[model samples]
Target: MIQQFRRFCAGLIVSLSAFGGFAGAAENADLLLSGPLFPAIETFHLENGMQVGVVPDARATFVTHMVWYRVGAADEASGKSGIAHFLEHLLFKGTEKFPGNAIDRTVKAVGGNHNAFTSHDYTGYFQKVTREHLPLMMEIEADRMMNVDFNAADVDVERQVVLEERARGIETSPRAQLSAAMDLALFKNHPYRRPIIGWRNEIESLNVDEIREFYERFYTPANAILIVAGNVTLDEVKSLAGKVYAPLQNRAPAYQPERPQEPDELRMRQVITVRDPKITNESITITFRVPSFRTGLPGENEAIDMLSEILSGTTRSRIYRDMVIDRQIATSAGAYAGSGARDDTTFALYATPKGEVTLEEMEKELFAAIDRIARDGVTSDELDRARKRLFANAIYAQDSASGLANILGRTLIVGNRLEDIRSWPDRLRAITPAQIQAVAAKFFDPDKAVIGLLRRPIDFETASLKKDPA
Candidate 1:
């Protein structure tokens, strides 16, 4: 009996190992050597000059219709910050063919979901629904693309909504407020300094005419890409797109000049204090300019990504282990590289210092970690873990229909091929520890960083009164 049990245990171990190996192989298979594993997208140009991309996936019963416009907050003029995001909200208010709430009602009745967002480089609208609702989704999206009704009353309503959103997303959160301030102080000539939701004053002052003009100028077929995925054939998508978007006349694309580079940081530190009754603790955010996705060298970009992961990629990361868990100086600490399409981007180190631990102490430890990485470089074990985590995330990203749409749309907007997305992991895997250290030494210079602090306000009035008006 003992001999039989041992044999069975050995067989079970072999079976489990085989299963694990097969699973790893399946995940790695999606990491294409040359391009994405997805079916070759059938591209078409409609009569109205709108570009269409179709990827047919018949495994699921649902479909995703996405419209991507080659405009974002970066397209906003000096004073027109947040107009792109504001306009995103206005598109849903109403249109000539369909009144306000008509599209929402139709989508809800069909058990579908719809939403849109604006970024630094693009704006997009998308819908997920049963295959039979493809034509309806396309028709409604096309109608709003060119025929949106930006009436005065609707503008007023959405303006308030956006303001409330800003208050929640920016005003109430010290971290977000500090981030906004850092951007404003960091970029003097670039539109990237402008907030995506626009400033409170700008949103309040934006009128109906400005909104309408922005719509007419940017929301055209020539400046847009339509992507349809899941539960549909290329022919069906093309036919539906032709009937819906082909009638709208195309306009010439809008043009914007390249943003100028930011000057060298002149100060070692800057502080911003916001006194709110609801506030509890102090926070610090450090930002440095790095090569953007558009112009970064192949190795440089990968190293930057790896550097971010090594410092703040997970709870086991250096910052979390040293500052938060071991020293107990900070509640949280991490680093991140902002994902953008420009030629220059920002890398940030943010932390919320704990009680009795000044922001300066937290900053010291954070920089120490960066300095150590620059001097000694990351270990092979660290590199292997980072690569494995990144690979897992890549596979997980493919599972979301909307996420896939956004990835493809954003990449195309930035003038990159879909293959670049698929080949990212192999590129990441090839990065050496020496390259990662070199990138840190090159870009993460303390003198080149913008440090902003949010703290409790001092009681100046009470202090002055106590000093006999001195």
Candidate 2:
């Protein structure tokens, strides 16, 4: 199965903050700093240039084996918009050795589950099985990594699946339509503007040759990372990987992402309106282009993260309290700063009005809330509370071994070092109130914003009639 598009542990970051654990924040930080973020993560490389990370946890008997390819939709050729994701679907068709549906049946017969996902920066496939079946999973994944075979017929069938997936996920959903519009307006030249699933026309035009070329070029040991987390030691993983994955040779030169860079001065504030008859409840979203962790200054990304938490990370957050609890104009409101991309990323605020409130009213309130923070800055209490919650969330994230695997894979694939991941706790704790206010004032400018509106066509007609009284 192709998992939904999610960057980092966005759900974990937001949902875990509301739990009570402030007293232990400092203690947890001290404990984590005493060693690696989690216990015993041993990483090494094969002669074929494949990097492997082994995280040993003996609490459970199951193991999660993941292979991450360091290429994604952002690395596609100019006209080949959807090739990265389309190839993801095709990889499951079959390999010459595994044959048709053999891998799927083999994993399921053992009561294991498997899935794959594609993002702007990487694509990954993972399977979870018991320790006894770990070697089998590795052999299957290793086989397909080099020997994935597909015909024109397979390509056609999977292309239809990809198209239907796009329809079910994006075409029929009003919010998805609005999000697509916002991306098109938000990014002027960067490939981030393209949908990860791809545009409909471009997807229809893709052929088997293009996909085969892509697979041969990028799907090599040199361009991939293997992450195994569960009941296994570094020595065991090293032995199994040496036997199974070591023989695979690199087909291409070392992986180097030649993605076109976003211009330094790409600034604009635009409105994107998406009206569909299916939309009964209207909403508004505002997105601002901000520096990602890979591109920002020393403390910029951390400050943006703190600012997001203080603004609307939970029901008790500033925007939600002001709109839903105090002013009573919105039913829901929140904010997110996506700082994990390879290039510049987004900071977004969204609101759905309560009863008969107009988008204009909600937009004004949202802008006012942000402007107030930019001007007055956050109080010491708010800063302390936000930092504690974030710190607690970081500690809680280590509970799942698979979750740690995901964090490691996403961070490393985007050109970050493991030390950066280990040092994030201290860096986030050190963020000051002035720094948060400075980023809020700097990136939340009117000129760098993209406002998205989703409404029913009937609402537009009604508003037009009221404005002119015709």
Residue 352, model 2: lDDT of 94
Tens digits of per-residue lDDT, candidate 1, 229-331, equal 8878888877788788888886656444366666654434455555555557777778877775566777787777778877876778789888899888889
List all candidate RMSDs to the true structure.
Answer: 10.2, 2.7
Q: What TM-score should be assigned to candidate 1?
A: 0.85
TM-score of model number 2:
0.93
TM-score of each: 0.85, 0.93
Superposed on all Cα atoms, model 2 deviates from the true structure by an RMSD in Å of 2.7
For residues 1-470, write the lDDT of model 2, one tens digit per residue: 43323332222222234333543563455445554455467688999999998878888678999999999888898888889899988877788778888889989999899989888888999999998899999999898899988699999998899999999989999888888788877787888888888899999999998899999999999899999999898999999999999999889866788777667587788888988888878899999888888888999988888888888766688999989999888988988777777777778888999898999898888888889989999998888777766766667666767877777777777777677776676686678889988998998987678999998786667789899996
lDDT of each: 0.72, 0.81
Clashing pairs in 2: none
Which stretches of candidate 2 lie above 4 Å from their native place? 1-36, 459-470
Top candidate (TM-score): 2
